[model samples]
Target: MLHAVIMAGGTGTRFWPASRAASPKQLLPLVGKSTMIRQTYERLEGLVPPEQTLIVTNQQLVEPIAEQIPELPVSQLVGEPCKRDTAPCIGLAALLVSRKDPDATMLVMPADHVIRSRNHFQSAVKQAVEMVGKSQAEIVTFGIKPTYPAEIFGYIHRGAAIDTRGDSAPSYVVKHFREKPNASTAAEYVSSGDYFWNSGIFIWKAKTILDALAAQQPEMLEHLKKIVDAWGTDKQDEVLEKEFTAIEGISIDYAVMEHAKNVAVIVAPYDWDDLGSWLSLARLLGTDRDENTIVGKHLGMNTKGTIIRSTDDHLVVTLGLKDCLVVHTPDATLVANKNDEESIRNIVKLLEQRGMTEYL
Candidate 1:
């Protein structure tokens, strides 16, 4: 059987004020009518039922996530005591799903991405499942065709094409993985046309990932095993808080995928967006005639290429501002240049350093 594991533990610090510590971007209804996590789960309707789905998030967010995704039983919502990045997160989920069915194929994805065309997304998943079914050792991941030079996302350098059974979608043997590159390197990669933005979406058999972790990351796997052993015990929380936070925080790419021999990339046939930062709002929600993406009450005189998000009660007025980002929450309002989106993380750090965590 196939299982869906949604990784929803991220704090989304870049989208601060609205995306706070307790309620992150995945919990918010940033994209559409439903929350981002709900949108992600709906994309797996026919492919994987709610019963087989699992959501891994921060312990504090467990109840909030349960409210939005009521279809999944509360038990299926796994809460991590602390942030250990994706490696430990996925490793834990793999063990839990594998316990039910040793032959389980798990579809792991983030909760904060905006992906249209569920059919196409599910189709790619099905194709990856097929690819995995044929050879369970082959770890399958999706590669979104980069429309531009993106400095934010990691890049996947795809190698020679692989046999996709019948070539439903383009499949390739994995070559190399590049971390977030500089603007010049990103442009060079884009010009080469062999790179795709690492979608961070992966599909593999439970045994496959566990085995890979055992090989490439034995020490971390041992700690994860201890956590798994304490899964149902009274000391579950105590051990998770201790072991998970102590584990080396690294992504799956560094922990396994980059070194795994049998890896493949399937060029996704769906429209995918990570919605990583505040600038992403302008991309997801288009701009008006003034080229400003306004979410709520906003009256701009010459705010072009600016992203404004406010509430119904507050009306933010901007004049003579271009390529700026203005987000108005009842508690905090963000005003910064859109081009300096990366500095949002610094602002969050500053807030944390100032001990003004009330705004975080």
Candidate 2:
């Protein structure tokens, strides 16, 4: 059986005001009519069924996510007791899938990305799954061709092509994984065609990943085993709360993918966007004649190269603002230079320190 695990635990502080603690970016309809997570589920229509699709999110978001994804079984929605980053998140899901069927193939993906081409995305995922079925590769991850020297995203270096059993899409062994680099280093990576943006999407057998975790991350694996043993029993939630807290918060990339030698990369054949920040949204929704990305009703006298978004019906009027980001919500409003988009997280921290919990 093939299962899909959608990682939806991110707080998305960069998209603050619009994205809050209770309701994150994955549940917001930032791009199209449907919420980001709903769009993600729809993309897997022909690939995986709703029953096999698992959503791993925060405990607070369980009910809201269930309401948004009514088709998904409430039992399949695994809620984390606390934030444990991607390593523990994927490990927990892997254990559950392994419990169902040890040989099950799991497709791990984030719920917040905006993928434009659904057909191509499905084809690529199917290709990766089929490739994994026939090959000895333990894990397969997707890599997007770099469009620019993005300093924020990690890069995957492509190694030599691996010999597959049949005529399949080109797959390369992963040479190395590079963390977010400085501008000069990022430019070097982009200049070399071997580097691809690490999409953070992965596919592997439930048991295979478990084996790797046992070798590379023994402590986390032990915790996962305890949780898996408790499944279907009354002690499941009790074990999860205790063991998950003990598991260290780390990314799967650093814990397994970067260290594992059996990893491979499938060059993604679709348009992908993480939708990480307001700058990304601005780029997706191109600027108007004044070079401003405006979502709601706004009247600007001399605003140029700015991004303005409002949820309320109130008309926003700007005066002589240029290259700015103005986001208006019911409780909070953010007005800053577009260059300061990366510092949105800092602003969120400031709000937290100032005891403005209502805005967050």
Candidate 3:
């Protein structure tokens, strides 16, 4: 059996005003009529059934998530007591799936990503699952072929090929995972042609990942074991609340993937985007003939190469602006230069320092 684990705990502060703590970007209709999470779930239709799908999210988002994804059972929706990053999140999901079927394969992915070629995405996922089953690879990650030198995404260096008999999709040993680099470093990585953008989608057997966790992240494994033991009992929620917060806050990349020697990468044969910031959204929804991307009614005199989005029913007017980002909501609005999209995190912190909880 194969199960899907969707990680949807991110706050998405970069898309502030539109993405709030209660309703994150995953629950918003950013790209189309369906929400991001809904699209993610739908993409896994034939790959994994709803009964086998698990969603790990924050406690505050449980209700909205449940509402948005009613097909998933309430039991399958596990909420972390606190935000402990991807390591704990993946560990917890692994435990839950192991309880159901220890030998089951788990496909871990984020909810807020865009994949244009659904057929290719599914084909790549099938290849990854087969690679894990047939080869010695215990952990398989999907790596997107880099189109350009992008500094925002992490890089995956490919090593020697792992031959899978008669399988067309090539799999390679992960040489290493590198953090986001400078412009020059990114350029060099692209020119080398041996690197791929770390897509963060992973596949592994439930028991295999658990064994790896025992070796690399023993403490986290032990905590997860305690929770798994208490699951379905009267003390389930009680134990989760007490133990989840005690676990260290770290990412799976730091705690497991980077250290695991049995990791492999499968080149993703599809168009993908993490949608990390407003600029990414603009990139997806390109400019009109006037060199502007407007999601709502807008009257512009001299605006070129800008993105303007508003939720309320009002006309947004701009004059003599070029290459800017304007996001308007009922409560608050953000007007910034597109180059400063990465600084949205800083703006979020500033909001916190100024005690603006309502906006957050």
TM-scores of all candidate predictions against the true structure: 0.96, 0.96, 0.96
Candidate 2 local lDDT, residue 82: 93
lDDT of 1 by residue, 109-176 (tens): 99999998998998899999988998833788899898889999999998998865564889888888
lDDT of 3 by residue, 45-70 (tens): 88899999999999998899899989
Count steric clashes of candidate 3: 0
Give the C-alpha lDDT of model 1. Answer: 0.89
* True-structure RMSD for candidate 1: 1.5
Report residue 87 deviation for candidate 2 (angstroms): 0.8
Models, CA RMSD each: 1.5, 1.6, 1.5
Q: Which sections of candidate 1 miss by over 4 Å? A: 165-167
Error of 1 at 193 (Å): 1.7
